[model samples]
Target: MILPVISDIHGNLSALERVLEKIDSDRILCCGDIVGYYTQPNECIGKLRQLKAISVTGNHDLACVTGDVHGFNPYAKEAMDWTKKVIKDRNIEFLRNLKRKIQIKINDVNIMMVHGSPRDPISEYIFPSTSDSTLKSFLESENADILIMGHTHTPFIRKFGDKLVFNPGSIGQPRDGDSRASFACLDVPANEVKIYRIKYDIDKVVTAIGDEKLPSFLGERLYDGI
Candidate 1:
């Protein structure tokens, strides 16, 4: 089976829709932050639900449900406050129900997924610059053939001995200096994962953010992919 892995959607339905159009998979795995930083939180959640995505809770997802935006920047806090006021009850419950991490087996390959790190699933950031020793420790302790995580919004595939760790990047808001939406496809039989970047309607998302009166910087950043 081909498994599509995605994360950090951040509520941009335009980007998510475009990414979905390119994927052909029976199941989708999400690393979380399904909502935040953009408009259309409900629509985004609805789409993921339709896909029956297996998702983990993200920091923003938890913040939206619990009204705890601590450590959030001014812009993020503003967006979260608006999200809390406008998000539907059912969708908030969905976020609250998500786990911080999950594990599954596909085609005999053991995979562990989390929004952040193995240590702190919901709020940590694992960048490509992280040391090999630290990553080796995580892989050793987790005991999975493959580890998947998202939060840094940068796509990468790394290998250590026979094990692998990868990030599918952000679908809505990419920070890898690439404006395209990002995702990864795991070929279960082959035990390989490949990253994909797709162009989407950013103008539509930016316009929606303005219509919703969200922070302008949020939309501006999408253009630069910063």
Candidate 2:
């Protein structure tokens, strides 16, 4: 099976659409934060539902449901408040019901998916800067051949012995200093992961943010992927 892995799509439907259009896969795995940064939360949620993506709940998604934006930065809190106000009732339920972690086997490869680290599935970050000892600990703890995660909005693929841990980055708000949308394709039969970056209509997203009266920095950061 070929699966497209995506995450951190904080409601920029244009970016999500572009990423989906380029990938051909049997199923899509999302690492969450489906809604919380931009203006099209409902639309993004609708698209994911249409695709039947296997997803985990992100910290932002949880905040939207609980109406608690504690620990979020000022900009994220503002967006979360707006998301709670604008998101449809059913979509809110979808986010509310998402799992914090999921384990699945595809073609005999045991895979684990989470929005953040397995230790703190909804909130912890596993960045490229993370020490090998820590990453190895996560892999050892899960006993998964491949551990897939998001939340850092930075794409990376790391290998420890035969085991792997990867982040597909942020489809909507990439912060790896790349302005393009990020995703990954897992080829189950071959046990290989390929990362891809696709350019979308940043101007359109920015214009929509402006139209929605969202924070200007939310739109501005997309151009630089910061």
Candidate 3:
């Protein structure tokens, strides 16, 4: 099975649209943050629902759907508030119902998917610099041959023993100093993974944010990827 995995899509429907256009896969798996940071919360949710992807909720999704902005950063809190006001009721319910993690078996390979670390799936930031011991602990606990996650917006594939951990980065708001959409595809049968970066019209997305009156920094960061 060829599965396309995307995560950290904090709104930015245009970027998500672009990424989807480039993926030709049988299934879609999302690591969440479906709503946050940018405008078009409802539209993004609508598209995700249409695709019926297997989605795991990220911290931003929890904050926006549950109206729990207190734990979010200043800018994230603002975006959550804005998203809460604009997201449709159905979308809110969808986010609320999303799983924090999912496990599936393909071609005898145990695959675990989460928005963050397996230990604390919803909020932990797992990046390339993360210690090997930390990765080992999650791998042992999850007991999966392959682990897939996204939260740090940096894509990488790490191997520990016979286990593999992969992060597909951020689809909407990349923070790896790149203003491009990032994702990954797993050829499960072949046990091969390919990371992909696709460029989109960042200016158009920025203009949409301006027209929608979202936080200016949200629009500005798209250019710098800060």
| Model 3 root mean square deviation, Cα atoms | 1.2
Worst 10 residues of 3 by lDDT: 64-73
Query: lDDT, candidate 3, residue 42?
Result: 83
TM-score of each: 0.97, 0.98, 0.96
- Scored against the true structure, residue 51 in model 3 reaches a CA lDDT of 84
Q: Count the backbone clashes (under 3 Å) in each candidate.
A: 0, 0, 0
Q: What is the C-alpha lDDT of each candidate?
A: 0.91, 0.91, 0.87
How do the residues 46-165 of candidate 3 rate in per-residue lDDT, one tens digit apiece? 888888888999999998877777657788887787788888888889989999989999878999999988888888888899888888788889888889999899999887756788
Candidate 1 error regions (>4 Å):
none
lDDT of 1 by residue, 130-204 (tens): 888878888888888889999999999888867889999999999999999999998777678999999999999
Ten residues in sequence with the least summed lDDT for candidate 2: 186-195
Ranking of all predicted structures according to lDDT, beginning with the best and ending with the worst: 2, 1, 3
RMSD from true fold, candidate 2: 0.9
**Of 2 and 3, which scores higher on TM-score?**
2
C-alpha RMSD by candidate, in order:
0.9, 0.9, 1.2
